[model samples]
Target: MKALVELANKAREVSGVRIYKRNVEAVLSAVLKSGDFWEIVDMSSLPVPAASGIVKVLIDEGILFIDDEENIKLTQKGFDFVRELGIETFEDHSCKACEGRGIPFYANIELYREFLQLTKDRPKAIRDYDQGSVTPETTISRVLFMDSRGDLRNKDIIVLGAEDDLTGLAIALTRKAKSVLVIDIDKRLIDFDNQIFKELGIDNARAMVWDLRNPLPEDILGNFDVFVSDPPETLPAFRAFIGRGIATLREEGGVGYFGLTLRDSSVFRWRDFQISLTSEFGVAITDIVQNFNHYITWDYHSETKAAELAPVKREPKTIWYKSAWYRIEALPGFKRWNEPISDDVFYLDEEGSTT
Candidate 1:
């Protein structure tokens, strides 16, 4: 039942709806008490699109049904599933750490705080808009999330791109990992990360300048246990970054973490990427955490001429963009060792040209 609830929660997250677990539980409870399994409930009654996604998952698992009227009905299997869940008497409990906010509390808060302080003076985003950095807290959360997945300790981790130094530094400061490597196209970011490591007396992490357009360096190929990236939202860029990340893995049992947002990439694009990863690259997506990143926006277009400006009323001041974090694993027996590299440009402006 817990596993099912978790899956339902993920489904909700993937639906791009900001909803709480308690609300999802409410929807399930309502469905169960509506008296008849054959009766249709209004889809609009669900708190978010994730409820709709859960229904779809249930239907796919042979536990629910969608009738001709587009109404949701329960199958016999669904009844048994629900009965096992004991939904009627189920009680939703809030997380004590995040106060039901879903953010996990770190065991060593002081260390995390220190790490944030160290990275406070990191470089700002370039004029190219090549990088939109997230808060230091968010990066630490990512490290903790990865640790929770049992992917961090004694592992050789690599960051495919390191626009934000907080992530690599957090991993290194923990001193649990064997080593940390950060590769980026931006020389300034690479230099900054290395400088942070040097100043802090951290020995396990190192940064290098490497563009994703070319193949990974031979020395590092198939050397890492895990790869982390926040690639551009475009398909070509995603393919290039993820493909390169996969290529850097140890052929079997290697994992990759990345961030994708619905703001730029749609659900359909996500589905296509998943298929490509699983079918073409032999990488299977294991988990996706929604709203994992809260990026702080900065103005990079102030220098643009008025003739090139879009008809916006004012600059956006609120932090609205969020990313869905993905965890993918390399399967055994097959590998894409000889995949051809493309020379396509990935970072384009809204008008579809390089910024």
Candidate 2:
């Protein structure tokens, strides 16, 4: 029965439902504890937007019941299943937002820690200091974000302009993805990534110096299952990076992950960017996780400016910047943006002003 529950959880994780398996399991355990076999459990307690769908999945699998009031109840099969798994009492041990995992709402703690250990000595954030790099926590969180979306195993992932190598290292260490390729303009970043890959004996991962200002390399065009980027928040820069990412993806069902922030970009900017992605690029915005990329202050920024800012005056002592993560999926036969990168794509003048 424990194996059966594990199997069910695995299936749910790989399913297109986009909700964590632990969330569904937690809901079930809660229902069993309520002792209301005839009463429907209120769906609001679950964290996922598709909570009703999860309940329906349980019902479809003969593990739950839905009364006329739309409340949830455990079936006899469900009770037996939980009992066999040794869930004698329902205790919510998971995190409230991420369920129990430390990363997203329900991260696998072991996996998260492994990611941190692997990327602990990642290349320092110096060359691209204006677009500050994320902390180890944020990097692992990105991996968790992808895991939550069922986008990791056997997937070919490309990171446009990988600065700190956190995401690339995390994916490679998983050893599940078919391939991990990072393209960046900075030779330093690329070299650092390759050295890490070599040191870790990660054969499936590689980094190359390919500027997004140019077209994606012909050998890898339209060959990836996922593309990840933390583009410059400006309109032109964002479009350029996202355009290159889309161009590298498989024609259909390809996933793109990127980060945007409210500090620099306004609602109107978000709307335009989203519309361009969906309408012109042929991808639908599926999910947006708020404050997903928390960044640490690095040495490049002027200390005078930091002191004048607010709250924290010292460098590396505070984490005041963050970006919201965006997950978009490609529709069948989606058109990829193939425009030439504009000259202003590397603009960082706004970086200091915004920070």
Report the number of the highest-TM-score candidate: 1
* Candidate 2's TM-score: 0.65
> What are the per-residue Cα lDDT tens digits for candidate 1 across 100-140?
32556366687678876776777787655357787666777
Clashes within 3 Å, all models in order: 1, 10
Runs of candidate 2 with Cα error greater than 4 angstroms are 1-106, 127-129, 303-317, 349-355
lDDT of 1 at 160: 83
Q: Clashing residue pairs, candidate 2?
A: 40-71, 40-72, 41-71, 41-72, 94-99, 94-100, 95-99, 95-100, 98-105, 98-106
- Residue 79 Cα positional deviation in candidate 1, in Å, after optimal superposition: 39
Candidate 1 lands at a TM-score of: 0.67
lDDT of 2 by residue, 125-240 (tens): 76342446886667777787787788888899998875563677777777888999988777777887788789878999998887676767677779999999988666667767
RMSD (Cα, Å) of candidate 1? 11.9
**lDDT of model number 2:** 0.65
